[model samples]
Each structure stands twice: as C-alpha cells, then as structure tokens.
Target chain A: MVQAYILIQTEVGKASTVADIIGKIPGVMQAEDVTGPYDVIVRAQADTVDALGRLVVAKVQQVEGITRTLTCPVVHL
Target chain B: MVQAYILIQTEVGKASTVADIIGKIPGVMQAEDVTGPYDVIVRAQADTVDALGRLVVAKVQQVEGITRTLTCPVVHL
Candidate 1:
C-alpha cells in the first residue's frame, strides 16, 4: 500500500470548500482545511506510486480552487 | 493546541537516523522515515504558532543530517 500526504494551497476563502470536495474523492482518506502556508492537508492511499500520482494530478488537482499541491509519499526504512 | 506536519529532507542515507533522533524530541509526536521528496515525516504540537515555529527551528532543525523542512500547520475550519 502506498500512502501520501498532500499539502494544498487554495484560493483565499476557498479552503473549506476545497477540502470538503477533496474528502469525497476516491483514495483520499481525509482532507481538512488548514491554516498556514498550506490551506488543506490530505491523506490518501493507492496501490502504487504511479497510481498515487494519478490520483493527485487527475483527481485532486482537478478540483476547483486548488492552486498547488505537494505530495509527500510515506516511506518505511 | 497547534499541530503541524513537518516534511523533512535529509542527506543521502540519513533518513532512518534522522527519524530516530527526531522521534525523541519533546514536542514531536511521531517521526517516520519516508521516501520521495521528503526523507522523514514528523507530527508535532505546541501551544501557539510562535512556539511551534521555535520547536521546528530550535529543535527539529537543530538535528544533524536534516537538509530542509517545510512545516504545514493543521487548521480547523
């Protein structure tokens, strides 16, 4: 299983709505509105890194109000 | 309480050691070795944003082997 944390920056005043929509996307475990450099934090999982990338780019990024996304994949060492 | 996720980048081959050391820090809730852009992912908490900043700059960043850190504070909407 591949898990990642997606840091998102949204348009001003759009954080809450963006997060709400992201939370319902398949593979997204949780999406929460947040304050700071990032406006939303997301936890998502997929079967592989490639699939994870697709989820972020094809699904998460397609959401309105999102400006940027930085996906940090969880790794075990 | 101010909670944040700290995405960390470390020198090559230092991810495990960095995570180990960071896990012992007082304010750090958890630290794990991870691959991709970040070498380690940390969860930490403080009483205020300023205190959180101090925890990152003074404590988390002080550890050797860390190259970069991006703090993403959690916000409730």
Candidate 2:
C-alpha cells in the first residue's frame, strides 16, 4: 500500500470547507483544517505509487478552494 | 487536546533514523520517513497549543539530524 500526506493551501477563509470536502474522498483517511504554511493536512492511501499520484492530481486537486498541494509519499527506508 | 503535524527535513541519509527516534517521543502519535521536500512527517498531540509548541521545539527539533521543522496545528475551523 502507498500512503502520503498532502499539505494543502487554500483560498482565504476556505480551509474548513476544503478540509471537510477532502475528508470524504474515497482514499482520504484523514483531512483536517490547520494553521500554518498550509491550510489543510490530509493523510491518504492507495494501492500503488502511480495510483497515489493520480489520487492527488485527479481527486484531491480538483476540490474547490484549494490553491496548491504538496504530496509527500511515505517510504519504508 | 491539541494536535499538529510536524513536517521535517533531515540531513541527507538521516530520514529513517530521525523518524525512528521521533516516533518514540511521548506526544508523537506517528512518525514516518517520506520522500519529498520534507524527509519525515509526524503527527503529535499535547494538552494545549502552547504545550504542542514546546513539544515541537523542546523534543522534536532537538533530535540529531533534523534540519528543519514546520508545525501545522489542527484547528476546528
């Protein structure tokens, strides 16, 4: 399984709504509004790296209010 | 309780070790090595926001090999 943390920046005053919408996405395990450089932090999982990339580009990015996303894929290392 | 995500950058080749040490901290719920701009991603909690900040500075950032840390505190709205 592939897991990643998606750090997101949203339009002004949109963090809560964006987090709420993202939390319901199929692969999202947790999505919460946060205060810092990024407005929302999301934990998600997929079957493979490619699928995880697609999930970020297709599903997560398409949500309204989102301005940017930084994906960090977990590694066993 | 106050929760936050600490995005960490570690010295080259130190990601795994940093994550290992951080995962053992008392307030840390999860710490994992990841591939991206940041080297490790950690989820932690404390009794208050101030306590969370102290946890990040006094504990998480003190770990050897860690270069930088950005704390994103979870917010209800």
Candidate 3:
C-alpha cells in the first residue's frame, strides 16, 4: 500500500468542516484540523502513486473551501 | 499536550538518517522518511506551544542534514 500525508489550506473558519468532510473519503485514513501553515492534515493510502494522485486531485481537492494541498508520500527509504 | 506534525526537508540522500535521529528525540512521537516535497515527516508533542517551538528549534533542527521544517500543530477545532 502507498500512504501519504496531505497538508491542506482552507478558507478562513472552514478548517473544521473541511476536515470533517475529508475524514469520510474512502482512501483517507484520518483527517483533522490543525494550526500553523495548514488548516487540515490528512493521512491517506492507495495502491499506487497514480491512484494517490487521483485521490488528491479528484476527491480531496474537490471539497469546498480548500485553497491548496501538499501531498507527501510515505517511503521505506 | 500540544501535538504537531513536522514536515522536514533534508540534504540529498539524508532522509533516513535525519528521520532516525529525530525519532530518538524525547518529544518526538514518530519520524519517518517520506517522498515528494518533504523528505521526512515527524509527530511531536510538548506541554505548551512555546515548548513545542523550543523542541523543534533546539532539537529537531539540530539534527545533521536537515534543511527546513514546517510544523503543523494539531488543534481541537
């Protein structure tokens, strides 16, 4: 399995809602509101890197109020 | 506890060593090598936000080969 951490930036006052919505997505393992440069932090997994990219672009990014996302894939090395 | 996910960047070919060193820090819950924009990802906690700042600046950043760090603190909201 390929796993990743997605750092998200959301519109002001939308962090909680964004996180709540993202937590329900199939590939998402966990999503929570966070402070600092990002508003939401998510852990997700897919079978391949391409699948992960599609999950981020198609599902996660489509959510309303999201401004940006940075996906970091977990690596054994 | 004030918990955070710290995204780390390291010199070329240094992700594993950086993660290994960070994982041994007292406040660090976990640290692992990761691909994409960031080379390492870390989970850490402290009693207060200030202490968290100190932990990152004083300990995590002190590790050899680390180039940059972006600290995202977990929030209840």
Candidate 4:
C-alpha cells in the first residue's frame, strides 16, 4: 500500500470544515485541523502510487475551501 | 495532549537515516522517509504546545542530517 501525508492550506476559517469532509473520504485515514503554515494535515493510503496521486487530485483537491495541498508519499528506503 | 505533524527536510541521501533516528525520539509516534518537498514526515505528541515546540527544537532539530522542520499542531477547531 502507498501511504502519504497531505499538508493542506484552506481558506480562512474553513480548516475544520475541510478536515471533517476529508476525514470521510475513502482513502483518508486521518484528517485534522492544524495551526501553522498549513491549516489541515491528512494521512491517507491507496493501493498504488498512481491511485494515490489520483486520490489527491480527484478527491481531496475537489473539496471546497482548500487553497493548496502538498502530498508527501512515504518511502520504504 | 498536544499532537502535531512535523515535516522535515534532510541533507542529501539522509532521508532514511533521519527517519530512523527521529522515530526513536520520545513523543514521536511515527517517522517515515517520504518523497516530495520534505524528506521525512513525523507524527508526535506532548503534554503541551510549549513542550511540543521544545521537543522539535531541542530533540528533532538536533539530529545531524535534518536541515529544516515545520511543526503543524493539531487543533480542535
């Protein structure tokens, strides 16, 4: 399985909403509002790298109120 | 408890080693090497925000291979 951490920046005052919505997405393992450069941080997993990419672009990004996202895929090495 | 995700950048070819070292630090729940802007992504917790800050600065950052760190503290809302 391919797992990743998705650092997200959301519109002002929308962090919690974004997290709540994202936490319910199929591949999302965890999503929480956070304080710092990114407003929310998400943990997700998929069967392959391509599927992981699609999850970010097709689902997570589609969520309203998100301004930006940085996907960091976990590496075994 | 104060929980946070710590995004880290490491020196060239140091990603795995950095992840190994960080995974052993107290309060660090998970640490893994990753591909993208950051080399390592860590999940950690502490008694308070100040303690979490200190853990990152005094412990996580002190590791030789780490170049930078961004701490995002989880919030209720």
Write candidate 3's Cα lDDT for A1-77 as tens digits.
89999989999999999999999999999998888888999999999999999999999999999999999889897
Please compute DockQ, using alpha carbons, for every candidate against the native two-chain complex: 0.58, 0.95, 0.81, 0.92
TM-score of 4: 0.96
Q: Write candidate 4's Cα lDDT for B27-66 as tens digits.
A: 9999998899999999999999999999999999999988
- Candidates in order: C-alpha RMSD to true structure: 2.2, 0.9, 1.4, 1.0
What would the per-residue lDDT of candidate 2 be over residues B1-77, giving only the tens digit for each residue?
99999999999999999999999999999999889899999999999999999999999999999999999888997
Ranking by DockQ: 2, 4, 3, 1
Each candidate's chain A: what TM-score? 0.98, 0.97, 0.98, 0.97
Error of 2 at B26 (Å): 0.4
The most accurate candidate by TM-score is 2
Candidate closer to the true structure by lDDT (higher is better), 3 or 4: 4
Worst 10 residues of 4 chain A by lDDT: A32-41
Candidate 1's residue-wise lDDT over A43-77, tens digit each? Answer: 89999999999999999999999999988888777
Displacement of the residue B46 alpha carbon in candidate 2, Å? 0.6
- Candidate 2, TM-score vs. the true structure? 0.97
DockQ of 3: 0.81
Model 4 agreement with the true structure over A21-72: per-residue lDDT tens digits: 9999999999998888999999999999999999999999999999999998
